[model samples]
Target: MLEDVFRDQWGRVLATLVGILGDIELAEDAAQEAFALASERWPRDGEPDNPTAWLITTARNRAIDRLRRDRTLARKTEQMGRELRDRPEDTMDDTTKLPDERLELLFACCHPALALEAQVALTLRTLGGLSTDDVAAAFLVPFETMSKRLSRAKRKIRAAGIPFAVPPAHVLPERLDAVLAVIYLVFNQGWGAGRVDLATEAIRLGQVLATLMPDESEVLALLALMLLNDSRRHARMRDDEIVLLDDQDRSLWNEQQIADGRSLLERATALRGSGPYVLQAAIADLHIRQPRDWEQIALLYGELGRITRSPVVELNRAIAVGEIAGPDAALELLEALDLGDYRYFHSTRADVLRRLGRDDEARLAYGRALELTAAGPEQRFLAMRVAELLPPGDRE
Candidate 1:
């Protein structure tokens, strides 16, 4: 019960506190304290009728109390406490009356002033309701590193006075790109890690973004892309093994989600959105078809790679290229790009090498990939590949 409520309300409570306190760190502290108190008391007290209002009041009061009593608090926080004390918000009981400031909070987290990594980490910690540890796992960084990064990001926001409000229409497009990137990064991390909670959270946030920016083509396209990719989740793994896309059971795929994603893609196309996300969504749409269009997929990937100049995109293009022009072409493309420390690069190269009858090289590539892979399914799959490349006696 507590976990569910925390997931549902943490963002709202934190956003409201940020609006009131004018400090991300302070807001987070207060929100956490409130939740902690809730955890302690909810079972005994039988959960509040209006949990949002209760949490907001509790967190705000806790922050204000600290600011007033803790002489060590900075003058800025002291001044904030004074201003909050003067406000009539103490008596505001209805959550419906409060403004939903998550959009503002999200935009601030994704502000161009911050580094892209910081933007992603901050947004996940705050708006996505992920723990700092959760963010670190998604980033494949140490907990200490993620903690320091979050601290630096919050300090930067405070030091630079990045406004906690959404940008105006004139600059919204440029700012929107960073927000989209952060959201997609979160989605991909969850998708790759097999954490459905994270993917579901990303889709939920995307839905909110779509509702807010109804006509934004890329926003629609991104949500469509995620849904389309997520539709195959049930079929992507089997008994601790990674199932290849072609080998996945189509019966396990979510037909409704596919339909919804296709509908969104059509809308994005109708809007004439040829942006990176739209292009990718179009590719995802093609991917789910009975006979995968490797040629068109390669062409779309080439276009995506040109726009982003990302080696990962090039790597994907190479996979489609392999289907069209054989292992030699894919191997040639892979060799030209430098994707250091990327697990999939080694795994893909291993597959291409194996297809070319280069067992020795494929075994070496699989071993490297296995060392880098952390996910249970992928790790097992890579290990199996390595064993397959060995002679029967050597395998034993």
Candidate 2:
């Protein structure tokens, strides 16, 4: 119970503290101290009636006390003290009128001035509530490296004097893409790690963004894409093994989520949103159909490829082309692309070769995929394919 509350409330409490204290490190320290206090007091006194409110009040008081004790913090304290005094503890409910500082924190983290990698790292750590270790693992970086990167990002934010507020409307479009990308990255990491909590948090944040910018078609489209993908979480794996999309039981898919996604897509289309996210969401919507329109999917991917000019999108388009035009054409398309090091590229090539009965090339491609991939389920599946390609008696 306590763990759930902490997971759900950590960002809200931390955001409130940062807003009040005007210092990230100080806010983090105070929040940690507040949680530690809760750990000690909650068991003895029973959990507070309004846990989030209690936590914010406790954390704010801690920050105020620290500021009072430290001579160096006196100026900041005085600056913030008036506003803090005006906002009473009783008004700290989850739905308090205090503008949700999380959106501000997110925008600040993804500011254009910061390096893109730093922006992603800061967003994941600060807004996603991921520990440095988890963030490092997600990005496949060493713990110490991730720690330094995070520290540097925070220092940059402080030194650069980046305001803790959302970007102006004229600049919102430019910055919003980075925020959306960070959220999706978080969701993808959680999906890969099988961390339901992280995935849930990402969805929650997406909903918040959508609510904050209702007319932003890409925001709605991104949320729709996530909901559509999340709807299949239950059927994506079985007994620790991957279940490919075509093989998954449709009955296991979340029908309501799919409906919601379709509705969002319709709204995006109504807004004349022809951006990459809306196109991608449109593709995902087609994939859920009983009889998928591969030609339409391929066309959408072509449109997306033109918009983004990304080789990855082209690769996806080739896959859809394979469905409509046959594996030979897909293999021809694959050979022209510069995706040698991409594991999925090799995996897709192997599938094409296997379908064409080119056992030797398929075996080599599968080996390359196995070597490149770090995912356990994918490695196991590829190994099984390799074993199948071996001679009858030579099979181990």
Top-scoring candidate (lDDT):
1
Cα misplacement distance, residue 291 of candidate 2 (Å): 0.9
- Candidate 1 lDDT over 1-396, as tens digits, reads 689889889888899889888889989999999999999999998999899999999898898898889998879768888988887974648988877788899899999999989998898889778898887877778899999999999999999999999899999888999899888887877653434366877897888788777788999999999999999999988885779888999999999999999999998889989899999999999999979999999999999999999999999999999999999999999999899699899999999999999999998888888889886777887888888888989866
Give stretches of model 1 more than 4 Å off: 36-49, 71-79, 89-91, 115-117, 133-145, 190-197, 318-396
**Model 2 clash number:** 0
lDDT of 2 by residue, 1-396 (tens): 777678677777788778877777778889888998998999899999878778888888877777666777557566676567666666776556554688888888888889878887887677667778877877778889999998998898889898899889898887898888877877776554433355666787788778778888999999899999999999998888989999998889999999998898888889999888999999999998869899999999999999999888889999999999999989998898898899989999999999999999999999999999887887999999999998899976
Off by over 4 Å in 2: 33-58, 74-96, 115-117, 130-148, 190-197, 390-396
TM-score (all chains, Cα) for each model: 0.78, 0.84
RMSD for all candidates, in order, please. Answer: 4.2, 3.4
How big is the positional error of residue 269 in model 1, measured in Å on the Cα after superposition? 3.0
The weakest ten consecutive residues by lDDT in model 2 span 189-198
Note the clash tally of each candidate. 0, 0
Clashing pairs in 1: none
